[model samples]
Target chain A: MDMAFDALSDASDEALLVLYGNGDPAAARSLTLRMGPLAFRVAMRMLGDRAEAEDLAQEAMLRLWKIAPEWRQGEAKVSTWLYRVVTNLATDRLRRRRGVGLDDAPEVADGAASAVERMIDADRAAALQLALDQLPARQRQAVILRHLEGLANPEIAAAMEIGVEAVESLTARGKRALAALLEGRREELGYGHD
Target chain B: MVMTDEKAKGLALDDFFAAARSDLPEPSGVFLARVLEDAEAVQAGFAAVPTAPPRAGLFARFADLVGGWPALGGMVTATLAGAWIGFVGVDRIDTISGAYFASAETLGTVNLLPDGDLLALAAE
Candidate 1:
């Protein structure tokens, strides 16, 4: 077990993708384990709904598996490609479901919690989520990729398929928009009091 | 005053986003397991299909040439010679056509007067 873990840990993303392309079942699992969190987080950040984010992440991973055989080497990192796919999927979902309220979507709890605590956390999360939901899709993606994911401008550009200057502009605009949306509710949302 | 106000607001917003990050939900282990299972099923589906193997290499093609290196070289040389001969033959045809035209002009100049007397009398 330790040996297998070590082997997986040592393998490059490209090598793992090649293995997956060659129809190795374990490689798919390993890839999902490695990329799932990032994909889910990006999707959630972009879509602001846990259920939708989960769906988008799974769909992106499924597409990744289906496309492994056609993946060309040195084009982009597997993780970057996955990010682009999830981002585009989430964007499409948002466009399709435009003008829908978050209240209508089912809420997901982090884990088992007391009724009161769950409500409090959910409300706070929901409020922040609303603010994120209000951002333009491109700005939201840019913010998630740059600030949350900590990608460099060039990397974000590559993932977003834009120029570096465009990335900088998008991130700056996204930050301004997010700040404006969250500013009024800061005290209500329990931020910056300390 | 504006710069200071903007800076403070920016810092406050950053702090707020930091707190928001903590409350973001995580995917449950069950969900993770299901995703992995789905991935496995996909891999299995792909495995059910067979793919063709890669084609032979350039070296293999070269080795398969029936005649040896000398024969191949001779074949290439013969092809080039045939092409050159065809090109030169076109030029030769053009030259023959030009000569034929010149001979036709010379024939047109031929005056076969039975005797120069009738032609001189007609001229007079």
Candidate 2:
């Protein structure tokens, strides 16, 4: 009965996933609600477009639902698996772009290329997102997972299918690039003194 | 002086990262609905691995009513035994019990009873 599924807010994601595999619909609803935002946020960070981000999030969640039945307990965390899925999907989308790649894409933030054209200065987050979008796919993935998602280096490594040193290297490079891109916007973005 | 400048640069970037974190894009209601729909669709195709068998049918219910197969077996054995007892004549049974007890006057066997009242007591 649906009524029997109450008090399930505290259940871990893996526990809920196992329940979903066992044909419990409540578990599905709860899991989707919990993990959907994470997928969307990461996808948005990796890919600047909202439409594509939503699609990737939905696709990642679909994969999660499909893998429910065979989800091995204590083998891996649900969030980590989800991070891997989102990053891989975003990477595929990045690769499929027409005439766009690490070397080919513009290095500067869109519209913030020169001192004459400052970032709109209304939204710091938007300014940061624009800078992040200019980064390579791997660096973006590492930065989003490490800084935005607050994941550890090892966990980011596991998610990105890379070594811990690679994760560190990507984040360091990503931060340096971000700093350079946003350096011209210090006064306009409201961080004049800092 | 250069280290100080680098520290300020790091601090500025940290502020931007914090803004991005706080300004996370919310998943639209439509997006949530679509995902839930997808989740339901995916779950629907799953082969339900029931740990136990399906619901009980009439015969199974009856078996349960009779306290399961062992109880039913015992009841059948008892019914057959009663039928057999009814089919046998009393005289034949008396012969067997009387021979065993040595209480039959015609058997000429040694009398083994204080009183010839075993079957009567058993019946009582």
Candidate of highest TM-score: 2
Off by over 4 Å in 1: A101-127, A190-194, B20-24, B53-124
lDDT of candidate 1 over A1-194, digit per residue (tens): 45555678778888898888887766777787787777788888888777888988988888887788888998899888987899989889888887676455443343322343333544555555666787778888887787667788888888889999998998888888767776665555555444
Root-mean-square deviation of candidate 1: 13.2
Taking chain A of model 1 alone, its TM-score versus the true chain A equals 0.82
TM-score of predicted chain A against the true chain A, for each candidate = 0.82, 0.86
- List residue ranges in candidate 2 displaced over 4 A: A1-6, A101-122, B47-124
Q: Candidate 2's residue-wise lDDT over B29-61, tens digit each?
A: 899999999988888888544457788999888
Residues A1-194 of candidate 2 have per-residue lDDT tens digits of: 35645666889999999998888889888887899999999999988889999999999999999998889999889999999999999999987874665466443344443443344333678888878888878998999999989999999999988899999999999998888878876776666663
The chain B TM-scores of all candidates, as shown, are 0.37, 0.42
lDDT of each: 0.74, 0.84
User: What RMSD does each model have against the real structure?
Assistant: 13.2, 10.4
Question: Interface RMSD for every prediction, one decimal?
Answer: 2.8, 1.8
Name the weakest run of 10 consecutive residues (lDDT summed) in model 1 chain B. B102-111
* Global Cα lDDT for candidate 2: 0.84
